[model samples]
Target chain A: EPEVTQTPSHQVTQMGQEVILRCVPISNHLYFYWYRQILGQKVEFLVSFYNNEISEKSEIFDDQFSVERPDGSNFTLKIRSTKLEDSAMYFCASSEEVGRNQPQHFGDGTRLSIL
Target chain B: GESVGLHLPTLSVQEGDNSIINCAYSNSASDYFIWYKQESGKGPQFIIDIRSNMDKRQGQRVTVLLNKTVKHLSLQIAATQPGDSAVYFCAENRLTGNQFYFGTGTSLTVIP
Candidate 1:
């Protein structure tokens, strides 16, 4: 089964520095999403991307966050300034299309650690 | 904003036994629901899903029961195995949007 893939299984960055997380969604998927999970907390939605644009975003996805589909296969999330609270496991998910019953498949996730 | 939540934080059961996980959703407008499993350090994996029009749906070793009257959902696992140990979450989708709201989750431990 084809699955979503993310680069840099783990990322460590200094506070105030910029960080970019990369994801390669399934080749045929049309909708992509990003979600984060704090150490022992519930997974939270960050943003959803479709047609090279953002469809929806949560409050956590503030001014510091931006998502870009620079190319056909790569989707990237850039954080302008990192903070301690930003440390968490970031997961990339993709669905064939946005519909009532379509399921979203997730990647293993990239653990981001801020120092 | 409504939320989906689990009733139990942790559950331990012996291998080969049946396990049941319950969830409560407060969104009356939600028409779709899904259950996912996540292992440590990994992302949520899709398990099974149910639509509000149906009262129950069954998969390989899992069954999802929906009680729309009480806004309750339950997942039943038959012949649970050690590999089934993980955190399970219930998520609901609103009829007007594509976003899914996830519940806190329930950790299941299968005793060997």
Candidate 2:
């Protein structure tokens, strides 16, 4: 099955550093999303991108967070000036199309640890 | 106001037995629901999904039942195995938005 792929299974950075997480969605997918899971907590939606624009975002997706589809296949999440609270597991997901019934597939996730 | 949560935090079942996990949603507009499984170090894996139009949908060894009136969803795994031991989460998506709100996740342990 075609799956979403994320780079750097784990990353460590300083609190004030900038970090960019990369994802390669399924070739045929049209909608992509970014989510985060704090340790032992529920998954939180960060943003969703479609047609090269941000379709939706959450309050957690503030000025520090931004998403980009620089090319046809690569989707990226950039966090400028990461805070200690930013330490969490970031997951990239995608679906073939936008619909109420389409299921979003997920990547293994990147464990971002800010010191 | 799109927060999905599970009723139980953890459940234990014997190998070869059936397991049922339940989730609840407060959003009445949520029209799509999905169940996902996650191991200790992996992302949420899609297991099955049900739309508001359907009350029940079945997949390979799993079945999903949705009750829109009560805003409740349940995932049933038949003949559960050790591999089925993981955290299960239910996500709800509404017609008003494309974002999916995930549940708190229920951890299942299969005793082999």
Candidate 3:
């Protein structure tokens, strides 16, 4: 089964520094999403990308965050200034299409540690 | 029975026993629900899902039961094993969008 792939399984960065998380979604998937799970908390949606543009975003995704489909297969999330609270497990997901019933496949995740 | 806690609620079951994890969703407009399993330090793995139109859906070793009237969902694991020990979360999809609201997970511990 094809699955989403996330790079740099673990990322450590200083607070206020920029960080870009990379993901390679399934080849045929049309929708890509980014979600974060803070330690001991529920997984939270960050943003969803379709057609090279953001379709939806949660309040947790603020001005410091942005997502881009840099190429056909690669989706990236950029945080202009990382904060200590940003430390969490960031997951990348891909779905065949965008709809309420479409199931999203997830990658193992990238553990971001903001120090 | 459910209780609120700062920690993930833990359920312990012996191997080969059946396990049922319950979830209560907040949105009445959610039409689709999914159950995911997350191992420590890993992303959520899709388990099974059910649409509001259906009351039950079965997978390999798991079954999802949806009670739309009460906004409740449950995942049942048959013949549970050590490999099934993980955090289980239920997520609900809005009637019109792609955002999934995840429930606070329950930790399943299969004692060998």
Candidate 4:
């Protein structure tokens, strides 16, 4: 089956540096999302995108965080001035359409480590 | 903020026994629920989902039961196998928003 794919399975960056996590959602998917899971913690929603605009975001998605669909297939999350707390597993998910019945499919995830 | 939680943190079942994982949500407005399984180094994989209008839904060897009144959800696996051992999570979505809130996961270990 077609699935979401993420690049740079593991990322290590300095505390003050900028990091961009990339994802290629299913080709036919119209809605994309970003979520993070701290070690041994529940998954937290960061943002959702549709029609090249943000549909919704959580408080955890602050000024330092931004998402972009630079092209037809790529969805990226950029975090500027990363901190130690920013280290976590970032996952990209997508669904063919938005509805009560459509379930989001997730990628394996990119492990982000801040030094 | 709304939250979803599991009833137990861990469960163990025999190789051929049936396993049931339970979850509870604090949001009364949640209209959709999903169950996901995650291995040690992987992201959550969708297993099954149910709408508030339905009390039960089944797929393959898995069954999902939803109780709208009590805000409860459960996933049942028939004849659990070693591959079925993983961390299970429950997620809920409210009609007013597109975001899904995930719950604490339950770790299931299958003793073969």
Candidate 1, residues B1-112: lDDT per residue as tens digits? 1123464588898999999888998799899999999998778899999999999999999999999999998899999999999999998888756778888899999999
Highest TM-score scorer: 4
TM-score per candidate, in order?
0.95, 0.95, 0.95, 0.96
Preferred candidate (DockQ higher): 3 or 4:
3
Look at candidate 4 and give me any clashing residue pairs: none
**Residues A58-101, model 2: lDDT tens digits:** 99999999999888789999999999999999999999987555
How many Å off is the CA of B57 in candidate 2?
Answer: 0.9
Q: DockQ for each of the predicted structures, in order?
A: 0.63, 0.73, 0.78, 0.70
What local lDDT does model 4 show for residue A101?
52
| Ranking according to DockQ, highest score first | 3, 2, 4, 1
Worst 10-residue stretch by lDDT in candidate 4 chain B?
B1-10
* RMSD value for candidate 4: 3.2
Candidate of highest lDDT: 4
lDDT (Cα, tens digit) per residue for candidate 4, span B1-112: 1123475688988899898888988799998889999998898999999989899999989999998889889899999999999999999998767778999989999999
- What's model 3's lDDT at A3? 87
Candidate 3's C-alpha runs over 4 A off are: B1-8
Q: Write the per-residue lDDT of candidate 4 for residues A14-90, one digit (tens) a residue.
A: 99999999999999999999999999899999999999999999999999999999999999999988999999999
Model 4: runs farther than 4 Å from truth? A99-101, B1-7
What is the descending lDDT order?
A: 4, 2, 1, 3
Clashing residue pairs, backbone N/CA/C < 3 A, model 2: none
lDDT accuracy of residue A99 in candidate 4: 55
